[model samples]
Target: MLLMNEKIKASEVALTGLRGEDLGIVGREEALAMAREAKVDLVCTSLLSSPPPCKLVARGAAKQTDAQEKKAERIQGGAVKTKELRLTAHIEEHDYETKLRQAEKLLTSGHAVQLTVKLAGAKEGERAKALIDRMLKELAPHGTRETGIQVSGKQAAVKVNPA
Candidate 1:
């Protein structure tokens, strides 16, 4: 529900005294004016609130200061959870590499990834196992296979960790 570059609801912005506060009931022009004065982005903090609004503060500075704390919380809480990569039956080498890069990004973000290799129709035999083995080897340097690769109903799932 929290979208980047989108306005947040009024009820969600926290009051930070004079430094920063929620722009409850403030229009776009007023927000821009406040930002012009404070020299910060009018970012919306809480989205799930009535009459979606924004918070007036410098997002770059705030994020830089709190990045570590936020990362720590994500590492502890599994809420920022696993990301998945879906592989098709006829994936090309370049496509595979692209998917791998995306998987790496997910892993770097401290997210567990489920690489799903799906097979259908004619391409459902020896080729599938070979592809799965290759993918598993690629994943070996990153995470140990806590639960070995599972293949069921023409799909194999590889769970990997952050390298």
Candidate 2:
């Protein structure tokens, strides 16, 4: 949590410089007074130090710093993209292998894969179900199946998320 002037509880707190180097421990009231006199805020920076730690900085400076840190983390961990691969009930073995390879590639690159097997009629729906089962088996090592095989209308689809 980002600590502020009033949230600080220690009667005495170690003061910190602008670069976060420790200055020394001082009475909390004096620190508050110094911040007030300097027309800035007194912020609690570290809670595990000997007397806890505080810093005097301009108002909103701590909040801005916190926001920047969070933004950096979000950017470091990129967003997950979802890629789809489609197949038919009577797909050739070579085409099935190609679809599996594409799905594996997407999963290895930290993307989710949506596998879809379209059925032309009720008669072909059972064959589509078998195809989906084979796909799940082949792709298990690359990703985890997030949902069970679901058949809606003429489509049987499953979602696989990166492991």
Candidate 3:
């Protein structure tokens, strides 16, 4: 946080900055006086330096910028949520279609879809792969595949995102 004018704690601060006037390292009292004369705030930009780095900027500008950034994040979904759907090795056609619709809805709502099928026996791998492939094919109109089938141990998974 940047302190304004009298609120500055450092006795002396490195006032030299790339964007503002070069006051170099000066007493806090003098910096406060300079900020008053310039009608700006004496802000402590860095507290880690030996004398601390301070800058002069218009009051409330930093807070306004921070608020704007937060607003933008809220507008953009901050972070995408991953929706996982697990399928059985032998799902009926109707049940598979229902699951596909659910995955499509998730993608359209700006969420990533994770479809997984776990095989208990080696012979069940083909069936799992087939189910994964069919899901991808049906979901093509609603989303794009972000990841192809990824197999680890006996589980195979895929990822999709809204188009």
Candidate 4:
């Protein structure tokens, strides 16, 4: 929460001008007087600081600035996009080619690709591994494998990233 003007309880504060110029330290009363003189609000920026930092901001500009900062943080903290492509050990040649083209397209467009192969019988694990290896080899020009093939019970998977 932000404390403005008379609501600020600190006796003294490190002040900044409306244009963000440092104004050093001043008594809360003096800061409020300055704010009043400049037709702006004295808003406490950081309450945890030694003397609490306050700035002179236009009436609604403080809230607007805070909202913009939050929006920027949300955009910067967004996660990378990832695409998943599932395959079968007994896939036909044409279907395999189609999947390879899709993976290539996804990788070239900057999306991380998770390649997964489903296994049926115990002996099918080798075929699944072979299939995954073949796909990785085909995709080598477009992407690099981020994780080595992982086989768990009836599935094998790998992560690939754009080169």
- TM-score, each model? 0.48, 0.53, 0.51, 0.52
Name model 2 segments beyond 4 Å from true: 1-78
In order of listing, the candidates' clash counts read 3, 0, 0, 0
Which one is best on lDDT? 4
Who is ahead in lDDT, 1 or 2? 2
Model 2 lDDT per residue over 23-45, tens place:
78898888888888877888887
Q: Give the winner by TM-score: 2 or 3.
A: 2
Q: In terms of lDDT, which candidate is stronger, 2 or 3?
A: 2
- Superposition error at 158 for model 1 (Å): 2.0
What TM-score, to 2 decimals, does candidate 2 have?
0.53
User: Residues 27-69, candidate 1, lDDT per residue (tens digit)?
Assistant: 5565555666876765554555554445555657546645767
Q: Cα deviation of 142 in candidate 4 (Å)? A: 0.7
Residue 158 in model 3: shift from native, Å?
0.5
**Cα lDDT, all candidates:** 0.63, 0.84, 0.79, 0.89
Candidate 4 on 22-58: residue-level lDDT in tens?
Answer: 9999999999999999899999988788799999999
lDDT of 3 at 117: 95
Error of 3 at 31 (Å): 58
Off by over 4 Å in 1: 1-74, 122-125
Clashing pairs in 1: 8-53, 9-52, 9-53
Residue 23 of candidate 4: its Cα lDDT?
96
lDDT of 2: 0.84
Question: By the lDDT metric, which is better: model 3 or model 4?
Answer: 4
